[model samples]
Target chain A: MRARLLRFGPDALGKAGVVGSGRLYAAVAAGGFRRYATYRAATLAGVFTNTVFGVILAYTYIALWDERPHLGGYDQSQALTYVWLGQALLTTMCVMGTGFEEELIERIRTGDIAIDLYRPADLQLWWLAQDLGRALFQLLGRGLIPFVLGAWLFDLSLPASPLTWLAFLVAVALGVLVSYSFRFLVALAAFWLMDGAGITQMAWLAGVFCSGMVLPLNVFPGVLGEVVRALPWAALIQAPADVLMGEADLLGTFAFQAGWAVALLGAGRLLQVVATRRVVVQGG
Target chain B: MDSHSHSHSQVDGSFDESHDSFSNNSFNESFIELDGVEKVFDVRKKTGFMRSERREVRAVDSISFRVARGEMVGYIGPNGAGKSTTIKMLTGILTPSGGRLRVAGIDPSRERTRLARRIGVVFGQRTTLWWDLPLIDSYKLMHRMYRIPDARYRENLDRCVELLELADLLDVPVRQLSLGQRMRGDIAAALLHDPEVLYLDEPTIGLDVISKARVREFLRDLNAERGTTVLLTTHDLQDIEQLCSRVMVIDHGRLMYDGPLTGLHEVGDSERTLVVDLERELPPVEVPSARVVRVEGPRQWLAFPASESAAPLVARIAAEYPLVDLSVREPDIEAVIAKMLHSMRDTPKPPPEQAERSGRAAS
Candidate 1:
């Protein structure tokens, strides 16, 4: 697979006129990958931070799961896995860093979005491809170390089947698409509001709380559990984590993620078209 | 490349003839056409606590013009004069609020993506290159994004790299490149797809003299060699003087003047200020063709027709008055447009004396 990817050269990108060409998206994804790969120091700092947070959260979960055994239908082992999974997926889902949305907001505020509009590509898909590359990088660079550390130190539920790993990858990919779509909609508010920072903050808060970053949605008491589980944010970290831990039906969880990805991406595409129509490029 | 050796004098002559023909509405081969195109922006300003007022700012009022293929045109105006607004409308970034606009027979705003393949734009204030990636990485990405064929991509890349002097800087990240280097990199990125029409907004805004000259030379050659149409907006009059044979002036969202470069001076009634330092403080020195616009102590400022030779005015002053030292200041675009608008408000046509002065200046 690596050799095949490397073999795709300039000619493989093919003609420019065709829309939705796989090679075109692949190149954009590669560009995105290379763009983030330059920040080696930032990646190191993020890995350190994620590992530190995972250790802290794992100890806290041990204490809580000890007091209320099998709370929210999760055994002690499963709860530990959930805690570590949250730490691993934090940056992967962009629950912690507002990198993509902040960049989009800055582009809109400074009128640099005009340069983006000049390109012969769909705006939403272009950003989606870039975000996928970023998520892949973050998952490998930041997600793995914390996960490995957690599994080594704590009694965590581990999946051994290659087939199950494949399902987890598919679930995470859909989760990334849903995350990008949701953030994209919030960023598009910059066209009307002129500054998306406030909305971005609110979006981030909701993502952190409802996506089960702070605590698993399954632990929420009463009606809130059902409510949080239904939100699009749940599709980002909670659903993917459930798939990884084998705590939920594989097809059912995949269906939930795929459904939110399609709905949110469709809404994002619609908002993008409308927002670009009234884009007031701030500077001459 | 051999055709590039054709003297600019011939190009200027042809441009003047085309200018006359264009004004007569006789040219039918225009690639960019705008008929009474308009763009109005609604801005809401905060006045007091929880109070705001909305106002419609007509950024590009009903302005119309046509740019032919292979013609290099200069679009000049003061800040907030709607110059960028019009370019935005032309590039389909900002849809016009009213009227018909077409580029290469395609309605730009309606079919913006299709039009994008044919046109390239450089916004001097912003960069489209990926900030964290190497300069060559941006080009490689553009190579795929535009999907220029492998052979043609290499050929165009080689040409731009050779002409723009981008070989050494390709490995450096975009953020590490200086403004001039980044600008060149950007220009090269825009041309890699072989766009037929190129729009440059303030391409030489912050470039130093050598860099500016190099950029201008590259642009001239690009236009000459590829026959690519160019619409350049700039504050630097020298950019207009050296690069463009036909200049269009826009102010207050209106097309104020569209003609040969020399005719702009005539219409604007622009003047050169001659600063004369006398031996001592005295009454304002008088000359036949120049008038003292200001006098302080031993120094005096004389305003004369910009098109006229300052040699005769200097000689007359030196022989008749004590001239310690003198220097001439060329009229800038803002001052020229201000004077032109002032004259236009006062008279529908050029006053007879001003016309005669331009004639003498021409001779």
Candidate 2:
């Protein structure tokens, strides 16, 4: 059996018009994007809510900066960038899988996971491809619009150097990896927990709190700030935010983001193995 | 083999009197083989608040059989009788606890992903298509997922759509389709890969009569022309009568009967009745081959072995008795199954050596 798979697996795939894994990944990613597009109303609603929150947070941070000079070592420009960029990064750093995480949970709970296992694609990579598509769409649809609104309305400062902008892009991509691996792990917990809601809520709460999504990590005094900086959650938000604000060195931020991406993705793969073996594929 | 007889007129076709037995020694050539395959599930039940008890449910118990290529076989039993479990094992969805199982000479559980390329499976109760996506989108996705050659995928898709009348449904979301429509969609999704083995679990479960007939016809053609080996699990007797040449009955994870569908009557020792109406009250009819078991005022009932032809006895009765009206009633497959299960309890278990030789348990 293994010999046949080794011999004809890729051969058959090509004959069947797969051409390569590139095509398969492209197809899955396209499916994810198209599926999200089907819910146009929901996407718009999410963007509206994000914009309202972005505007409100920007004003609130501006007011706080008026009261003090460099609170948490961030001046008015850096603080305003944190609020607006953080709003743009909200959907991208989906550590909870709210958008696509339900798919894994539903499949596991309903025994539809059986069909998932039957596919030739690796499960983690399949999901990662899907999130990558969603992230790209979010970046354009939700991320770009709100950031532009903040810049035009509040006179937000743009990154001065082309190098910093390039580093920010790299940081954002790595941040996706960190968030996706963690969401994948949270989703797989459905096999053991039987319900992913609790885990999902807890994961996102910890992620939002520690990643400086609501409040900048600099505001947290002493060891607490250092602790949040060391964790992978910071890579999801603070790393990208820092690169955009020029608060941290571009290389250091990219290194931490890149390191966590590889580590968490590897850990996610190991957890998936355990989940498959212990699978109690639910229902008929 | 002729140990029992019956006369069921409702049956559409005569049972294949000759057996298409698969011998143990010829296992090397068979398309599917299961030697003492067993699956035990560990189920935990709540004993009380904050307390639970663990138990084991043997879904497939030491089942052994072989299905030669192009053979359409029926795998059936009452609910919880392990019919689904056996199919799950064959598909490698659930690993068996013991024994050996092979499909196309490959161990299913150990190399399931590899073996998936060679097999197709449909569970009627579930939807394999993306529920919110249009039917064609699901098919297109499966086209990539299975890596089906573009030309072959198109050919199969066009054929299935034409035959299954799914041309109008391509743009509809699966959740909007009727049960029968969804089932047809699911079946087509499984076949897009052009698998050598097709395992259908209750393909006709919730379909209307016309839909059921359509599904049965499509399957018949699929097996005849493509020679796709099918293992069907269904509760509808007509499905078995119309499609499967061989029927296997399992109860409590034990196979009780394994042979032609008509042979079920003989195994169960069930009887078929002939109802006769007379002009007036009369004494029991005298007959050599059949005995009158009931005498209504103007109606008499004759019970005979269900496997035998009613022709001879009908001829003899016409020659001597006053017959106003008559009709032959076929024994229900459910009744035959009940009687078979009941009789099994009265007889001692056949020695394993003897049972294995026959390729069926005296279950």
Candidate 3:
């Protein structure tokens, strides 16, 4: 046992070293970060538009409900909170535009993917890490800041417990993982289909409608709502919002999120492996 | 006598064995290997939702070559001749339909990451450097990506700046630099990791003569000093002539010729032109071993096989005419290559000026 452990130690360390050495993840992270810095003006405009849209959505909900007891187990305050949360998470989760898929297609067309293939890190994992970094920056710069400002102006419900906050944090992290894996799977379509943009747009549309970004999943018809809740898309946004509102049990909510994360990430990995094999066979 | 004969046979056997080993070693040391590689692309036409039209285009058909360690090989072909397709396969950007490829001792398709670590590449028309940042910042970012040690990074940066003459351009953003400056900086960025192999696709495609000379000089020095095997694909024959001793010419997805540069000139039966200026108007004269191409005022021009000795033709013309001035021009490589490509039909004639000179020279 000791010998085996000793042998495995160096190999594991070496693998980690390789990942850190910028073969895949580091290059992508650098690229994504640089891209964000360059597109600062555009990001600011996107944030402004998103915040204004959130306020309009909150006002529209207020007119419909008008302090009437509650609709779909959410009061006016909770409804307003949901609106702000959805707006913030929209940017963080990249609900409007799954840009990574387009990036992958362009990379494929231009043969830039060759640079990524040579890296010592898994391409999927590298892209996920870079996306995660971008999400973090956007969530802070575009998502969280805008939401806080909007909430202060609109009198939205804030979470009451540190436990709820902690749960919300975990949910958001898992949400990003699940969301990125799903997007990556869509991006891998470039290997098989020549114009992957149409399919990518459809995937983003599905996420927007089903993930409760434009409206809460509970508003869907009974059977459709049930189906939507069970899907990974809802878990990326709705589950985090539920946790923040104290409407979900911490352990149960996280357990479901974990399940979705594992399943989606596994699916992504399988698709990536198969897509890469096709690329090798077809010379994409 | 029997013992002597046996010893001689033994020596010959060992020589053969060593020669075989040497050939195998040469192939093994190559950074890239394409063995009977074939890539056939399916050309499809999609019309609304119906079944699409399908046509087959053999982009890279049964091409094979080896780029040895530190050997700067140029892969050139006309447009749509599968140069990019072949490059894509070598870099693991695309896969071959049939045949095997190994890059940097790894099957590029199977062990892409391992191969990537051993090679650095740059596409001339595209900017891989960050568009917004200064060239130095981009280099620093690449340093982080490749995880170069700080000391080694500094040393390589210093050397690249000195060799590429990039000291003045480092502070400028890539978007701001002139094409020549940007190209030099881009090449430096690709070399930061000290990759054992470098692939440059059209590195001098669009540059002033001085810039082209600087790039060629840098590439030549880098190859000689570092032994970093290079695979360059360019439309510029001047680049190939000056930098590459060996040339591989591909046409219509097939390797037409792969040998020394001299072999290119030898493959086709072409002719060199000799222009002679006489002190007086010259009458056309019939001469053996040469064709009289044209006659103008005081000048006469003639064409002879490039393989034919210039001395004999020059001596013949001088003995017959009062020669005031004389010069010899070798046929352009572009014309030669074009002729070789289109030789199945009538070859395209040289430019009018060249034709006039050749006509006058031949007459």
Best by DockQ: 1
How does residue A178 of candidate 1 score in lDDT? 86
Q: Which stretches of candidate 1 lie over 4 Å from their true place?
A: A1-20, B1-28, B41-57, B275-287, B292-301, B314-327, B348-363
- In candidate 3, residue A270 scores what lDDT? 72
Q: What is candidate 3's DockQ? A: 0.21
How do the residues A197-226 of candidate 2 rate in per-residue lDDT, one tens digit apiece?
788888878987888887898888889888
Question: Where is the poorest 10-residue window by lDDT in model 1 chain A?
Answer: A1-10
Per-residue lDDT, model 2, residue A39, is: 72
Worst window of 10 by summed lDDT in candidate 3 chain B: B1-10
lDDT of 2: 0.79
Q: lDDT tens string, model 3, B209-277? A: 999999999999999999988888887767887899777766667665565555555554567788889
Clashing pairs in 1: none
Q: What C-alpha lDDT values do all the predictions have?
A: 0.82, 0.79, 0.73
Please, what are the lDDT tens digits per residue for candidate 2 over residues B9-88?
A: 11111222111333343433578877778877777899999999987766677777778889999988777778867877
Top TM-score prediction, candidate number:
1
* Superposed Cα deviation of residue A118, candidate 1 (Å): 1.0
Candidate 1 has a DockQ of 0.45
Would you list the rank order by lDDT, best first? Answer: 1, 2, 3
